[model samples]
Target chain A: MRISPTDVAQVMTLLHDDPEFRFLILSDLCGVDTGSVMQVVYHLWSDATPDWLRVIVDGLPREDPRAPSVTFLWNGAEWAEREAYDMFGIIFEGNRDLRRIYMPPDYQSFPLRKDFLLADDAARSPGQGVRHMEQTFQPAEYRRTPVLRQGLGSDAGHMAPGIQTAELASGEDPAR
Target chain B: MTTEQTVRSLDDPDLFVETPGTIYDAIPPLPPRTEREAEFYTMRDGEMLINLGPQHPSTHGVLRVVLKIDGERVVDLDPVLGYLHRGVEKICENGDWHHAISNCDPLEYIAAMFSEAMPVMVAEKLLDLGVPRRAEYIRVLAWELNRISSHALFVGWLALDLGGLTPILYGFIERDEIVEMLAALTGQRLLFNYLRIGGVNGDLNHDFLSRLGDWMGNALKRIEDQQKLLNSNEIFVARTRGLGVIDRDLARRTLLSGPVLRATGIPYDVRRAHPYSVYPELEFTIPTREEGDSYARYLLHLDEIKQSIHIIDQVLHRMPDGPVMAKVPRLMRVPPGRAYVSIESPRGQYSAYGMSDGSDQPFRLRIHDPSFFNLQAVGLLMPGNLVADTMAIMASVDPIMGGVDK
Candidate 1:
């Protein structure tokens, strides 16, 4: 679901407090870059059932990406949040030890971003300064972006305008 | 001297100051406040920093756990990972959906079946592909076989870590038998890329089934012989019994699962709780021990192996005969959606979270490895124990650095 970055910590706290929706384990917390914006995805799972709830906070400004951290709620989120920050350069507010995980401490750019160029691939060949693959080597249809779907809303799992919630089944404690 | 003259004088050889020895020897030792440290000078301010391994055998893989110790107890601990990081998630994002199955084979190298199955199941979920009944049965059969072998290796390694050599050799015997069976079924021994997106790579044959049946019949006796070798040994019990007792709350807080969590009295098993594949039809118990110690965790491995054998027996009897692979396209494109599919791996609840942007390749592929999370509990388990007990606690956790670093 798409939510404001400001409300992420509060919403996570609310979900954690709810007896009906026991999202006890923070299964995974990761971030993605969608051209114009950065989106942070949080996957929560209840131990009792097969249900998993996904919470997405999208449309964070690309220039200064920041989201509230949930380490205080789930201690396991400590490393996961650091990893998210490491990959996407999205700062997790209030993370005491928010350090780079996979990448080196002095890494200049987030490697996962669409615009970031790999060092090896970015270097020009001996004689060919800047050569682009011609039409003869056009990539497959699936490799190219499909006629741009109705923006990030449709791209991030049919998530409605804001705070959308869906489940595999009903009566299994739907999130508020 | 003037400020400019003073700065320039620092470069003059006459004014230069030199320590008597190398850089490390130049620093003087800190003053000791207690009798424990009064006898000798310590490396840091009252604490010693020890790097356990990036190359030590007991660590099981390339995992470097820095331990800060005061006397014989651990004062602080920090695990340094990424020694084996191959950017697997990023690699999966760039590759086609079908090829990514092979890419994930090394994440949990000890039990490659579970790691390989995760991406396949997630892609299957995203595409809404229904695996054949026979294929599901085959998957469970292979998965159980892999689980038994992985646990066998763990039991042997635990004994080896606690300074006993014979149990590990016996462990190799059991593990070799299971691996030989799996290798015959799936063309590879360690990283079997046998499981594909739609279904498994191939079907079980008569030769494989007969051999597996014979092995399954005597598997319990072999496992028991291994348990008897180490379970009652006075030294083994003394070292591991109450060495690292992680309670239920700490296990939950640390996000521990599988045997470690089961050892703490939680009867949570992803296969039983979530009921993935053909696990719903099969009946087996999720073994739990109230002790929440290394000994309990060790016993849990033995108990769980027996349960896996029971599951294999059920699969063998109710084996269906049909097409193994579903009709998947040459190049598969998953619809724009997000799905998280988890299986009860030998270590814990190993999950694959795939986000597809209606492309042949995934936009992002995040793997929630159980060993990666379970390894975190070492900090809680290692604080009060003696220095020697560190090996026992780490062995009990059974962390595979391939999974942890990935």
Candidate 2:
């Protein structure tokens, strides 16, 4: 069932404390960036229900998504909340140790956000008229070309200008 | 200058003075990041900190715990993780639906079948696809075999960590036989990218069935031999029994699953709880122990191996015949929806949560690794125990760093 971020603590408490709907086990807690909004999804298990009860805290602002911590109900939620915070930058407000779990403490960006492009993603989907690496590659022609020799010569010149060109064993100069 | 003058120059007070800082000082001081870290780092009178592994063998993988010890007893511990973090979830979300299966394989390397099965099952849920009965049987067969191999390693490693060398050799022998059987079936040894979205990648062949037939004949005897080697060994019993005891309440509070939870007298197996695949048809018992100690957990692993073998036998007997692959499109686009599927992995409930936005690629993929949950119990269990018992407790918990860090 979908609930507001504010009702997370209240609903979870009722479900946990109420004997009628005893969702004792917090199976999973994850953060999702849905391009437009942020969501904190909680999967709870109980003897009362055969299926896992999924509680989605929907429509938290993407800029600074905040969800009430469920650590009070289950201690295992602490690490899961930390992981969510680390990957998506969604703050679990009541969690005492809400530091980064998987990333370094000084890590700047939340990697799971839609805007956070991976290092290679930029080269794969370059903007405007720029050709992507996959688009430019023709394996058959690439193999036929002496690209490695040309690249090595240019790299050597760029790296050390003082190096003299040496003659090959076949009496051919690389400078030619 | 003379030798005496040179020696005097070298020993000059001004020259001998340490510089305020150097190029090496570029690395900033990493003070405690969280409340737990700050508390653990602050040494009290007679309390010292012990940093154990990002590199220790007993840690299972790259997990480092900062143990605060007051003499021999552990005061508190702060487990520092993320050394093996590969950002698998983000990578899965970026790839196509099919790519997600292969990507999930490395999340729990030891039980790659379950890891691969998670995404496939979740995707199947999203698409409302049905797997063939034969495929379901095959999946269960593969899963049980994988479970046996994983539990074998766990049993051996736990003993090895406690300084017994023989059990691990027996463990590897059992593991190798099963792994080779899998390799024959899947065409890969470690990371078998065998599970597809609607069904399994390949069907059972002659080579795989012949190997399975041969192994099943002596599997029980071999398992018994391995168990007899360490089951009543005095040192093994003394080290493991009554060590790192987790009560029923603590196990529930921490959301512990698999053998760890089973060892706590809670007979909560995912196969029985939420019947999936061919488990509903297959007859196998969920074993439980009342003790909730390290020894109980170890015994539970052996019990589970037998149960898996029993399930495998039933699967082989009732094997159905049909096409393995379903009619999934090359570029499969799932309708906008969210699906979650959790299966009983060797260690615990390995779950995958997927969100699709009417695209080939998933919007988000969340993997709930049970090892991550089970590993947390170590912090609570280790506080009052001796420093040497740390390895024993951790080994019993059996947190694969690959899953923990992921």
lDDT of 2: 0.83
Q: In candidate 1, which residue pairs get closer than 3 Å at backbone N, Cα or C atoms, i.e. clash?
A: none
Top-DockQ candidate index: 2
> lDDT per residue, candidate 1, B1-406, as tens digits?
1222223455667443321221112111222212222212222345666778778888888877777788998876767677788878877876788778889999999999999987799889999999999999999999999999999999989999899999888889888887888888897989999998888889997767777877887899998898889889999999999878988877776778889999999888888777889888999999999999999999999999999999888998999999999999988989998898888999998988888999898887888888888787787688877787898999999988888878
Can you give the lDDT of residue B29 in candidate 1?
Answer: 21
Candidate 2 residues lying further than 4 Å off, grouped into runs, are: A128-176, B1-31
Q: What is the DockQ of each candidate?
A: 0.10, 0.16
Residues B215-307 of candidate 2: C-alpha lDDT, one tens digit per residue: 999999988998888888999999999999999999998889999999999988899988888888888899999999999999999999999
User: TM-score (chain B) for model 2?
Assistant: 0.93
lDDT of each structure? Answer: 0.77, 0.83
lDDT of 1 by residue, A6-73 (tens): 89988998887789877776767778887789998887778656777889998888899998888778
Off by over 4 Å in 1: A119-176, B1-45
Supply the DockQ value of model 1. 0.10
